[model samples]
Target: MRDAVGRRTFLKRSAMGSAASLTPTGLLAVGAGQAQKPAAPSERVRVGLIGVGVRGRDHHLRFLGANPRVEIAAICDVDRSRADFAGQLALRGSKRRPLIFGDFRSLLDRKDIDAVVIATPDHWHSIIAIQAMEAGKDVYCEKPLTLFIAEGRRMVNVARQYGTVIQVGSQQRSDWHFRRAVALVRRQRIGRLKRIVTHLGNPGTTSGAFINPGVWEPVQTPPEGLDFNMWLGPAPYHEYSPNRCHFEFRYNLDHSGGRITDWGAHHNDIAQWALDMDASGPVRIEGKGGFNKAGPYDYANYLEVHYTYGNGIELVCENEHGNGVRFEGSDGWINVTRLRLDASSPEILTEPVSGQDIRAYDEKNKSEEIPGTDEHHNNWLDCIKSRQRCAADIETGHRSATVCHLGNIAMRLGRKLEWDPDKEQFVGDAGANILKDKPFRAPWRL
Candidate 1:
């Protein structure tokens, strides 16, 4: 009852909820985890981490390793150095040695593991998540859930088909201020929502970005401990370059959608949730991009995308806004980001929720305590035991990722596109449709 839109308020009025058989019981299932029967503390959730890179080790390992009700069974990465490094940290921190794996499948093959956390590159998310779900392991996958729109659909379908308990790594959904921001917007604290703006930073300037005027990165041999071929699974093989791996991989079209899918996946996702369009998407989109003119840098150097939602709401994504989401309505506006939350009329943010007010608007929050702004990992663990959905469930993630993909498609094709969100296709453009999915490089099939 303490956070944002209390459960009943959320399911009934925001983000939509439940259906026939396949749909989630609730979109975020906000407090649904605690409402169900509790799992004994001794019943630990055995987690296997699939990528030991920055986020995998820094966040996932840090959080999961601390939870008393979870055990990190293994750590896997294409890069042995990363895997071993994180594994050592895990051992020292948790006082338990976890198996280290070069290939993700080795971790997935272990029947002892109950869930997998995928922090691999954008291209590897779909295949690894799909297999994890099919193997009956719940998943906590990082943002930009899929490399392509088609892959997002496949993830959603496979999640439903397998009854997978998945949590997308759009961690902001579980942050306290964001939860309150979304709740206030849904409650009309800002009046009828008119427009939303997100200031996602420039995509073309990632530290080691290869195409920035004066950089010469030539093909190099794969690093000693890395299995480059396995790392390239599903993506077309390209000669190794320092720019082609780690953080820099995002700037490449073959592996990512630049900031469009990277940062857009986060801010755009929050925008979708604020608009209560988690199950649906925009009807029209167009982009104006300062694409690199004389180089192979496929991503736009400066990008701005405009989307018109079915409810006649407009969302603009660009770099000028300074890295946060601002929701503007008829009366006032509310702004939020990981670091801060402020509003045009501060009174709306300062207003306190009374005990009487809680019962009048929402009751599910009265029934249970939703997992608060922790790492958002506990919500997944709780949902796994409760058999409920998470704060960032698969469908919600797919829809958010779709918003990113749509913007990327518009920018790439340099056209105004009409989309049928329900049908999951471009209205009439064959070229746009063709880009929905890319053929996975051989041997790896969804």
Candidate 2:
């Protein structure tokens, strides 16, 4: 039986660098080569939505709500009702009601749609985004850019090859406070950065044998209106259980990377962004955690991973404190989470950032007001129209997500590992490198 790791070699040999050569210029020529030709500023663009579950609904609300320059042209979901609900929402009080589909492929077939917002599960992000870009549509994918490190690199390569505006949904990068915090640190307001501590809180355990709810038993039967097989696309097939689907999917290793990837995709992303380590990542990762027995979920409930960068910056992910991020520097340390920012120097938080400090990081446009809005959704839309990169592009998202995944891998292996960002593999440990990618179910190639 062949594993996913072996397939990487096969893909690399067969493609022979074809995937890497698909540069922006080449992709533009293939898909929207003529997109550069100016059209009317008021010209409306159509969008298709894939995966209308929790985050997907939020995407629909934003795009269909205001944004007069774009329209929701289609919606797709494994759950029929969920897709219909989104379509209805888009149609409400509009001249055009978007078409609904159970399969994203059908939506991709429509030439009227110019882009897609993929809010699918972690495992499905890369494949769907790649296919959408190949089909000539821009993509706005939810954060943690890829399920695995290799997938992240592949997605980045594919996006560049297709010349599509791909945005990773790490909205905190767009937050005013977060960006300001990073800017201040980069500007040396905090002096030489020493160590950055990130707290993701505790994810706890998801063990103990528990049967499914009465309505969802019988093993063979799936819930009403839900297409379990479609939802499991690209992921190995498993028994349909509500606990393993939807939001709860994040707790499982096979489907998601638990809290490390779930919340880390958001908070750790800022840690990486603040450090200005978008293209590169930690050279070392070591994990310490325990797990629970029973159930298919196999991930660390509590983990503390230490990452070392070449610049002498140490990033620590601790599960002890509440969820937040802190940047420690020689002058002072600044901590910013979802709520507030705190520092040793009271002036750091309140003192108006000077023009000199802002110019140091080249963030002269940094505003006291919350930076960008709509959770970075509007940024993507505006970029699509202007033909510019989104705030959190694929490369940025991938690097941040890679940090989370690396932490999980180190924790699982219970040892330290050296990482090669350019090659995207573990240096000497073949066993560790094998975890870089995962096996896909048959007939669902990425």
Candidate 3:
């Protein structure tokens, strides 16, 4: 059985490799060869902005301001105010401002736009991404890549089918310090990796029970100039509750995967990258948690999940210490987060990347801390022009998101699950298998 499984994996990868060689997007080549020449700054790439809320605004400003090569050609948001605000921002220094629309499809219809940046809520990610790629635009969608495992697979398929360059928004993958940590582990500089612990901080509490009355009541009217229905998109119908929308959407299951996917997307991505598990994930997962009854949320507030890989590596995900990652190996252990990198052997942080040991994507062949700016958004823009895969490509994003979903599913089911990464199924666990995908409301199909 082991031999047969190995043969199957080999065949699948071989077929994928062959197909990738003929792809026009040129993703696989970057993975296989040395970094390509830098893209010319004078050659501009036109972009369309989708979902211009908080993240959308950030992308709009960075791409339009920082990247001289990018021009914001269109902006779309269900909220009229947001769309108008984005248009104003895009027109600040330009003679011709980008066209604005309340519907994303209208923006996609334009022929001048070359790519799209999707910064919408979690539930809207897959659908928007699928549509954009189908419309012949490269995509940079925020993570976790999909709301569920099945949607992620579909997104991957659609990107491949369109031969589009799709970069997932796991920004830590672009961080120089974080990439250094992964390099150290892969080089065995940390010795043989034994285990990994990812700390996700405390799962925030929802509204208190006593506050439920006020929280449950909808505002008298939808905010001025906002299209509530379009914002809701394919998510199940619900009254306009601020807590259930916008940034607060993270707490709900209908539109978000809770903190599991929120912080999990970032930490789990680094965990998977260091473990060299970009194409695959744990064979088994188990989790335990408690939920809050006083809130509209249906997901866990606190949880600890254990994932065991086929190669004997163990990854622990817990809502305990503040957000960070720790890698334990035979020689020592290293802990890294947005702020710091510390290890039993501090030398690991300073170790140089030798000629044979440098990562393929390390264009300058610079050491750990010396790579390009740690700004993930800028890195994606740089890669788009260079025709190189961004630090967090679709495959990397999918695997990390899969890990996050697996943890959530395990905690929700209160049972252990055996996963097949290639088949993307739960073996002999019918109950858990059901959580792999959720039913999309009518008119929305992956």
Candidate whose lDDT is highest:
1
| TM-score of model number 1 | 0.86
User: Model 3 misses residue 407 by how many Å?
Assistant: 0.6
**lDDT measured at residue 396 in model 3 versus the true structure, 0 to 100:** 80
lDDT, candidates in the order shown: 0.78, 0.73, 0.74
Collision pairs in model 2: 22-161, 176-371
What is the Å distance of residue 256 in model 1 from its true position? 1.1
Per-candidate TM-score against the hidden true structure = 0.86, 0.84, 0.85
Q: Rank the candidates by TM-score, best first.
A: 1, 3, 2
- Residue-level lDDT of model 3, residues 152-244, one tens digit each, is 888888777765667788877766556667777778877999999888874222111111111455555679887887788888888787777
**Residue 361 of candidate 3: its Cα lDDT?**
31
Q: Candidate 2, which ten residues in sequence have the lowest lDDT sum? A: 24-33
Which digits, one per residue and each the tens of the lDDT, describe model 1 over residues 399-422? 998998898889888999999999
**Can you tell me which runs of candidate 3 are displaced by over 4 Å?**
1-42, 202-220, 355-375
